[model samples]
Target: MKRIESEQNASIKQWKKLYTRKERDKLGQYIIEGPHLIEEAMNHNVQIAHLIIEESYQMPHDWEQLRLDPWVVSKKIMGILSDTEHPQGVLAICRMSSKELQVKAGGKYLLVDGVQDPGNLGTIIRTADAAGLDGIVLGEGTVDVYNSKVLRSTQGSLFHLPVVKGNLQDWIAACRQEQVPVFVSALKGAESLHDVQSSGTFALVVGNEGSGVRMEIMESADQLVYIPMFGNAESLNVAVAAGIMLYELQKNRK
Candidate 1:
């Protein structure tokens, strides 16, 4: 019911800061666009700092009865909030969930190494959720999971899983401490995916788009494995490769 028409409104200025990762870190919040992502955040009980809607657009029927009233903004202001070519006219400011990753005995985990593509990272997260993995550890060079493109590509799966950032070496050591075998996906001097059997409790490391896993991490892995490529194509997209490896690792467990 509250309307903000001025582009220079103090609240609007503060909201714009969310567009950058630094500001998001400083403010402890990020923006999620469209109805689906908003619904996902709401369902997860993530703290909704603000529910912002374009002034010309009517609030969704389901949202009107919510305990929080939507803050209406001018269409010009909505344009500033939107990152996409076609604005969804609805967006939310959501607090980041506290990091929930801890290596446990007999747990299945995915370790990502410097995966820079937002879409690929998002797909990998969705795949991990579908595979029912315990959690995902994102190494230093990985893209921010909160990146807008990555968020959109996740299709709400990110909210369904526990994802946390960590140092790859520390994570590897923790897994080893728990007796979980760590397997690195590599292109050379590695066993085939078919030849590598999961130990039930294991950690799978997927790497960068072009460079693959870092040499140091690969060397530290309990074993290195590669997907068999019989077709003309040289390699698989990092995301596709991840999906295959994760599913195969769990295939015989049941």
Candidate 2:
């Protein structure tokens, strides 16, 4: 195995570019860390560019026989490339192609509005997968779906569904075209989520943790609903609210 000991190694430099959104966009490649995400990508049959591993990290049984690991890297170099606290010891740079995210809600769709927390976004992606969402749309100002922390949070589940990035107005209009009810989570004039029955084909618009959905988007929603807050605490995390909404939506789906 070719070892990359020098920090200035060309491949190392290329992988470092994964940290930047610009570079990731330019290359159409994003970095994925840990065994879980790698396995997830594989299970999803997404194209794999390079599989990098440290000498100490054992390659998975499936990976060992594959054409992966074009090169071996050092712990230090792997550390430099990884973004996690406890690095997965293995990493892969994957090429992502558009999954053709559809706004027409056939089953369920999650529309995120400027959610910045990586963990929150990741959890939401995982939740969406569990809920059997048809797709997810990231409105402008929303966190990058490929962000490292968000990627880690998803634990490879992001591969399960179609995720698209665009403005809310345009996508919501498309949903309306498909006759899907739009449900917006709002703090005011919002009906109790339990009181309102979820439609089979529906879209859930989740706002930012601090600021709710943009006024324009909220105004366009067919119905605005709120999760009943029994406790005295303030609103729930954007992701938590998303999970609840998905739970209810999925419960009604089946």
Candidate 3:
């Protein structure tokens, strides 16, 4: 294991740059902090480029057996790398998967559009995984899935399934070719979510917090469905609405 004592270390400088989306994309890697998320990455066989630990922290016994060859860094260096106010003493730089996912018949997916909040995007990913969807499609204008807050918000669920970034229109076109139904959530002129019949194989589209789904995409949906509101609340948070719709759709899956 390497011991890195200086914040000026070349590797540490590069790792710190990962905090930016542009740098992360350029490097094709992202940092995940906390023991739980790192463990999930290992369990899921996600390629971990570096396992970093603060000098004072003790690694778990099981982890030591894996021979990860972690870099031991001073507390100061860890603090510089950590995104959280309270550093967890451990984190990793993981390689991004290069696999491309396709939208096909007989599979269920969640399509996100223009969700700018990292927490919302992460929660949507977590909810989709919990609901047992095949995968998630992050449409253009969605927040980067590798954002630190997004990674933390997912609570390790991101490792459980494929989350692909792609063009929504292309994905929707593919879904149509596969004879899969596409349901877009909207406010006006949309059927109540309870009134729509899910065919077990469909794509559920959720959109921006302020503008809702784009009119062009909504118009392309096979059905536009909205959750019935009994209370005075005008709308649901995108993540909450997604959770409700995902479970409801999954409940009737064949």
Pitting candidate 2 against candidate 3, the one with the higher lDDT is 3
Residue 195 CA displacement from its true place in model 2, Å? 0.8
Indicate the TM-score of model 1. Answer: 0.95
lDDT of 3 at 231: 100
At residue 17, what lDDT does model 3 achieve?
95
What C-alpha lDDT do the candidate models reach, one value each? 0.91, 0.86, 0.91
- Candidate 2 lDDT for residue 97: 56
Among these predictions, the greatest TM-score belongs to: 3
Which residue runs does candidate 2 get wrong by more than 4 Å? 252-254
> Candidate 3 has what TM-score?
0.97
Give candidates' CA RMSD values in order. 1.4, 1.6, 1.2
Model 1 bad stretches (over 4 Å): 252-254
lDDT of 2 by residue, 1-254 (tens): 67787999888988898888899889999999888888889989889988888888877777777657556777888888888677778888899756887655475788999998889999999998888889899998988888888888998888989888988898889889988889999989989888777667889999887898999999999999989989997799888899998788656653
Query: lDDT per residue, candidate 1, 1-254, as tens digits?
Result: 78887888998889888888898889889989999999988888788999999987777777777777889987889998898999999989989989588899999999999999999999999999998989999998999998889999999888988999989999999999999999999999999888777778889999999999999999999999899988899999999999999988777353
Stronger candidate by TM-score (2 vs 3):
3
TM-score of each: 0.95, 0.95, 0.97
